[model samples]
Target: MSDGARVIVGVSGSLHSLTALHRAAEEARARQAVLVPVLAWTPVGGERNYRARPCPPLLRAWQELAEGRLEQALGQAFGGLPIGLPSQPMVLRGEAAAVLTGLADRPDDLLVVSSGEQGGLRTGLRRALRRSVARQCLKRARCGVLVVPPSTLHEDLRALHRGIDLRELAAA
Candidate 1:
C-alpha cells in the first residue's frame, strides 16, 4: 500500500515456488517495492531430533545448503536477480509458512506463495497430512496474500509423468 512496502515470497526450489517467485518479482516491479525472497529449512530429522543431539558442523552445512538452494531458485527464476528491482534473499531455519508470515508482518507488505498442488498420489497423500504454506499464510499473514497457481507447463509435465500422452490429448 505504501511506497516503501515490500513483496515477500516463499521460494523452495519447486516449480510452483519458482512460478510464485516470478509473479512476486512482477508485483514488486509494478509496485516499486523491494522483493524479499525467503527460503526456510528445517534440520534433517526435524527440530526435536536435532535438539536432542545438536551437531554444530552439520547445522552449519545445512545452513549453507539452504543458502545455495535460495540462490539456485533465484537463478532459475530470473537467470539472476531481476534487474531494476531491489531484492533481498534470505535463508531461515523454520517452516515455510511461519517464516514467510513472520517476514511479511507489515500491513502494506505483500506475501506471495504457490498453490502447492501437485498431481501424484504420493504427493497428494503427503500434502493431505500437512497444511500447505499458502493455506497457512492466508490464515496467518497480516499483509496482503497472493497465491499463484502452478503454471500450465507444470501441469503438462505432471500429466506427462503420469503417462498421459500430450500428442494424443492434443489430437483428441
Candidate 2:
C-alpha cells in the first residue's frame, strides 16, 4: 500500500499486543501512513448492570494514571522519530477484531492484529476465538488484514530476514 494511508493496530495490556503495536507503527512509517494505535479493553464479559456508574475516587485515580501512561508511550513511540509518519493512540471499548472491522471503513486502511497465545489447555479456546475473529475481520474490513503470528514478529520470537543488510538499510 502507499504511504499516507491509515493503519489501525489493536493493542491490549499484553506484551504480545505491544509488540504488534510496535510493528504496526514501523510498518506505517515504512508505508508513509498515519499510525492509529487502538488500545481496546473489554470490561469482563460485558456484565455491567450500570449500578449508578459513578466514579469512585480510587477508580478515577487509576484511570487517570493509565491514560497518562498511554499518552507517554504514544509520544515516545511516535514523537521520537525524526522524519516519519504521524501516529496517534485511540482508546476503544470493545472486542479487538469486532472494533477493527467496524472502524475499517476505507480500503486504504490496514488492520494489524496479533495471532494470539499458543500452547496450553486454554490454547484451543484462544485459537477458536482468534480464528472466528480473523475470519470476520478479513471479510469485513474494507482494506487488508494483517493477522500476525506471535512468533513471526515479537522480539522473543523473530526470524532472521534472508539476504537483508540491516546496516545499509538503516543508513538508507
Candidate 3:
C-alpha cells in the first residue's frame, strides 16, 4: 500500500508454493522491498449456491483455517533465515489467480507464483481447460512476474532451499 515496492507471492500448503515463497522473499531482500504472502480461497460451490450470504460463522471458520495455513507456510519457508524481512501474511477471499494478478498494478511491484508441477494429470487437465495462475499472470500482470516451475532432477527442492537466482528461475 505504501510507495515502496512489494514482492507479492501467492502461497498454499504445497511444495511449489513454498518454493515460490522462498524465492519471493529473496527477491524482496535483493530489492530492499516488502514481502507479502497471500493465500486466497473461495467457498465450495455447494456453499455458495445454498445460501444467500453464506453462513457468517462458516465464512469466519474458513478465514481462520486459511490464516493458519498461511502462517504455517511462512514459518516453513523462512524458518531458518538469519534475519527477518518486512513481510505480511494475507488471507484473501477470492480466486487465487485473480487476486494475485490484481496486485501487480504498481510499476515496481513484483509478483511470484509457482507452476503446478506437483499436480498430476487431473490438475494438468483442469489447468489446460482453465488457465493456471502462472499463465493468467503472464497474460494479465502489469509488473514483473516470476513463475518458479516445478523443480526437476537438476533443480530440486533441496537446491531451491539453498538458493537459486530468481532471474534464472524465472527465465527457466
Top candidate by TM-score: 1
The TM-score ranking, best first, is: 1, 3, 2
**Which residue pairs overlap in candidate 1's backbone?**
none
Over 102-138, each residue of candidate 2 has an lDDT whose tens digit, in order, gives 8866878889877666565677887765565556777
Candidate 3 at residue 164, lDDT? 70
lDDT of 3 by residue, 1-172 (tens): 3468899999987888987888898898889888989998877664456376668788788889998888888778776331568887788888788888886688899999998665558777887777788888888899999998765642555457668765676688
Which has the higher lDDT value, candidate number 1 or candidate number 3? Answer: 1
Candidate 1, residues 11-116: lDDT per residue as tens digits? Answer: 9999999999999999998888999999999999899999999999999999999999999998998888888889999999998899999989998899999998
Candidate 1 lDDT (Cα, 0 to 1)? 0.92
Task: Indicate whether candidate 2 or candidate 3 has the larger TM-score.
Answer: 3
- The best-first sequence of candidates by lDDT reads 1, 3, 2
List candidate 3 segments past 4 Å from native. 1-3, 46-53, 80-82, 118-120, 153-172
Q: Estimate each model's TM-score.
A: 0.94, 0.65, 0.79
